[model samples]
Target chain A: MDREALFQQIKKKNSYLCIGLDTDLEKIPQHLRSTADPIFEFNKQIIDATHEYCVAYKPNIAFYEALGPKGWESLQKTMDYIPKGLFTIADAKRGDIGNTSALYARTFFEYFNFDSVTVAPYMGEDSVKPFLYKDKWVILLAHTSNPGSSDFQLIESVVTGRKLYEEVLLKSQRWATPDQLMYVVGATQAEKMESIRAQAPEHFFLVPGIGAQGGDLKMVSQYGMNAQCGLLVNSARAIIYASNGQDFAQRARQEAVNVRDEMARHLQDYYK
Target chain B: MDREALFQQIKKKNSYLCIGLDTDLEKIPQHLRSTADPIFEFNKQIIDATHEYCVAYKPNIAFYEALGPKGWESLQKTMDYIPKGLFTIADAKRGDIGNTSALYARTFFEYFNFDSVTVAPYMGEDSVKPFLYKDKWVILLAHTSNPGSSDFQLIESVVTGRKLYEEVLLKSQRWATPDQLMYVVGATQAEKMESIRAQAPEHFFLVPGIGAQGGDLKMVSQYGMNAQCGLLVNSARAIIYASNGQDFAQRARQEAVNVRDEMARHLQDYYK
Candidate 1:
């Protein structure tokens, strides 16, 4: 999906929600485990129930990877099931050298057909450059939601007198435009959003650390919003794992709708 | 494999060579393409031919992943077939937030049973901590071999006056001991290895960019090697793609022997 189509989805849906399918076998409903393919069945229902309320779906690749070949199969099925008009983010934080990274770009972009794949910036330009195709995105990891994010990201750079994450934002732009590149800034660190927005105002920010992760959405939108509504606030566990019963899908939709309503208000207030 | 076990393998084989099984379908022998599983077949032959010479086998995950589910199956079979006592490194440069990272650790370690998996440190302590397990290693990307390594890694940090990669080496050490950790300092940048060794001399360095990428082995060993022969210099294309005919395995074995012979001299000079 291109910048305009994604922005249009947000305008039409009145939500900048990106629902994460961090589906785990053990975490899915007990009743569904008896089904032929429980993981895919779970995701299928979740997409069917909640696709209307969100503009994107982010599937955390690790959840599928842990199950081996079968897990990949489940992921493929889930990818095949998600409705069009909803952007897909393969929350697979992959990066490597030039030749190797090109293969990864092929995996997510061509093999799996995700709109974008999250990439780690630690490997620098060549590793990430392969993931930037027309309308496809390379959502680079910035200041992440996890506490471990503080390990290297907060270190101040001597040359620029900026934090490592800030340097990441400033230097990485040389590789791709705002349209092809985005950053994964944690919603938990919403206070930093204003400054991060200042660094790359046009690029969309894929914000995790919401709901179950305890990020305040209003604060995130208040600081992070741009003219194009440059934010994709992701909610995974809180929405997908809302219920373990057969009512799981319905509960997930309810959760998404509730979040969507809040996001819709933010979109209206900011844009109007 | 544990540190001592790895050391023993190095001594027993008279080599610290880590053969990169970046087996691409198109790159494999054309005759093997007629086989049901060409990638795995190519890898099996290469492993059989070269296992005695090299202490480790690093499968670049992107190569396998590009082929989709069948590619993963080939990887599983290849993993199952690698002889015991030889170390396995999943060169999947994967990192994510805490919970998601845990799933990735499970994917490479538990599901695939790799001795270690390469991790990118962009997300910080928690993202990488999950990959360190009993006898399993977390090989972090330090000064990479790529020209792009100069991109973010060489940037000087304001607080410490150390480059970003230097900070990564210092700060990341607190998360895991030398036993559970290794750093990938590229062979092409052998000049920097002297100071890199000064940072954490006790930990092993997984050096790539040797053969096809044009990294000098002697210089890398001279600067990087410690008392324990702390280097696993990798050569992927030059060895594996040495021949594309019926004699491919023989040529691969010959290439491994040549690299192994050089590594033996380094081990003797460094340790003795």
Candidate 2:
């Protein structure tokens, strides 16, 4: 989906939350375990419960893949369960040689029909460019929240004097237009949000780590929001696995609603 | 596997070649099409015929992922078919947030039982550190051969004032010792092998783009070799689908033998 349509949805729902469906079989409610496919069953109910409160759903590929063949089936079913208007992300951090990456793009975009996929910039342009079609979004990894993030991503280059992640944000901008490219800047690193916004003010940032990861929502919105209200704050475990009892889906919706309500406050300040 | 064990296999077989099992269903031999599972049947034959000549088998995950559930079943069977002593790789370009990335590490290392997996370091150290464990390796993407690599990977960073890829190599070294980490430096970009070797020096490099991508094997060997002869040069289509007829496995063996002979010369130089 295009940016304008995505923007319209955010405005319509009064939220910028993207609920992450990092569903795992062992973690879901025991009541759903007896189903033929517990992962997909859990996901179907969660999507149904939380659809209205969030603008998007991100299904991390690893959780599904760990289940082997059955996991992939669950991923495909979950993608179909998500409604058309809401954005869907195949959170498969894929990047490879050009030809191989093209096939990956085909798998997520054509066969599975995801609106976007997260990409790793370490492979350079050819690996990421193949994923960018007419309206498909390529969310490049910029500054991450993990402690080890300081190891490589924060390194200062000897030639240009910019940190490595900053160069990734600056250089990757040349490959695709702002409409087609987005950056992944973790919500935990709220301090860097202002510098990131200044560098790529026109692009959207897919910010993960709000609820469970302890990233402050207000701080992220204050520094990262642009003229377009360009941010998608994702909260995975804090929502989907909110409860392990029969009321799991109901509890998930409550958690999603809580995040959405907080996001509404951010949107009000965002517009002002 | 440890570098000493890998080197022992290279010495015993007199080959440094790693055959890439990028098995695509449409590309399998026609006779195999009648088998219960064409993709798995094709992989089994290739592994049976070429197991003695090659020390490793690299399966590109996207090929298996595209077929959905059935394809994944084929991938597991293919992994099972390879001889126990031979090195195995899941060419899954995975990198994500720290906690989520830890799950991916478990998926491949525990569930899939791959000796190593490819990683994209754009998400920084946290995305990569979770993959390093006892006896398992995380091969990070370094310098790829694609046309768009110059856009971000080769750009000059203003902070460190060096090219972006160099910073990744230099900074990521601190996270893991050489044995636990490897880097993927494309064979097509052989000219830069000198610099890569200088920076990485001790780590093994998973070199793609050798056969089908038209990279010169001789030039790559010259500049990319390390003290331990640390390079896993892969050839995918040029070996696995060497012939589309019924004699595909036999042809695949012949192609692998040819690369093995060439690799012998490179290893010989290392011993010298």
Candidate 3:
């Protein structure tokens, strides 16, 4: 999806919420375990119950990948099942050399047909450039939510005097515009978001680490929002795994509604 | 495979040559295109022809992943087909959060039974630690071969005065021992290999960019090799796509023999 289309979805839904389908077989409802493809079945119900409450679905690829060929089948089925209008993010942190990365771009953007795929910036320009198609988005990892993110990303560059993540934000801008590129600025780094916002004023930030990771949505929305409501706040475990009983889908919808309602209030206040 | 076992393989074969199975439908011979699983068929023939000349098989995951579920099936078949003693490297270059990384580790290690998987160090310790299992290896990207490697990796850190890749090498060592840890020190960055060898003397270095990418084998061997012959120099297109006809597998075998011969000479000179 393009920048304006995504913005319109946020305006229409009154929520910048992106539900993460980090579905694991071990964590799903006991009844669904009997199904032929429990992962896809679980994702289908989650989408049905909560599609209206969010504008995007981010499926963490590892969960599907762990299941082997069947997992790939489940992921393909889930991709086919998600509602067309909702922006889909393949939370597959993939990046490689030029030729290999082009194949990955084809994998996610063409084969699986995700609207966007998250990419790691450790490999640099050529690795990321292949994913920058006209409508498809490259959500580059800038400042990640994990504690290990501080390892290299926070290191100060002698030449630029910018921290590594800041350099990522600054240098990657040269590769792609705000239209095709977005930053994965973790919600846990709320204080850093203000400075990050200043660095990439127009680019949308896919904000992970909200619910399960204990990131405050209000603080993230307040500091990270732009005129176009440039933030896609992701909630994974806290929403999807709200209940492991038969009421899992219903409980997930309730959790989604609670988050969406809060996002709606934030849209009115911070999304100018 | 463990460090001593891998070194023993090098001693037994007199080759540290790693052939990369970057099998693409468009690039393989036309005859194989008619097969039920062309990718797997092509890989099987290539492995049949070249297995003895190379100690390791690095299947670039992007090629398999591009074909979706069927592609994954081909990968599993190829993994199953590879002879037991030969080392296997999943050139996936995948790393995420702790939980996600664990799933990826499981996907490559348990599900597919790869000896090692390449990991990008952008997310840091927790992202890499999960892959450092007993006998399984985490081949971290150090100085990559691409032109863009100069972009972020070469950036000097103000605090440490070391390059970003240097910091990665130093910090990642604290996460895993040489037994379970390796580094993807691209052969294109041969000039930097000496210092890299100094920083990571014991750990194995899975070097790419040798044949098709024009990295000099002698220079890479001179600077990168250690007591255990700590270099698995990879050549994907140069060996695999040597021909596109019925002579393809034979040509691939010839290329593998050429690389293996050179690697044997280097092993005699450099394996201390």
What number of clashing residue pairs does each candidate have, in the order they appear? 3, 17, 0
- Ten consecutive residues with minimal summed lDDT in candidate 1 chain B? B209-218
Candidate 1 local lDDT, B153-211, one digit each (tens) = 88786767888889889998998999999998886555588889999989999988776
Task: Sort candidate 1 into its docking category.
Answer: high
lDDT by residue (tens digit), candidate 3, A1-272: 78999999999999889999999999999999999989999999999999999999999999998998899999999999998889999998897978899999999999999999999999899878999887999999999878898999989999889999999999999999999999999876566889999999999999888663233788888898998999999999999999999999999999999888888888988744
Candidate 1 ranges beyond 4 A from true positions? A188-191, A212-215, B188-190, B212-215
Candidate 2 regions with alpha-carbon error over 4 angstroms: A157-161, A188-191, A212-215, B155-163, B188-191, B212-215
> Model 2 over residues A1-272: C-alpha lDDT tens digits?
99999889999998888999988878999988999998989999999999999999999888888888888888888888899899988888787757688888988999889989888877677777888898899988888776767756776765667777888899888888889998889866556889899999999999887663233888898999888889898988999989999999999999988888888888898797
Ranking by TM-score: 3, 1, 2
TM-score, per-candidate, Cα-based: 0.97, 0.93, 0.98
Off by over 4 Å in 3: A212-215, B212-215
lDDT of 2: 0.84
Task: Order candidates by DockQ, high to low.
Answer: 3, 1, 2
Query: Model 2 misses residue A122 by how many Å?
Result: 1.2
Candidate 1 chain A weakest ten by summed lDDT:
A208-217
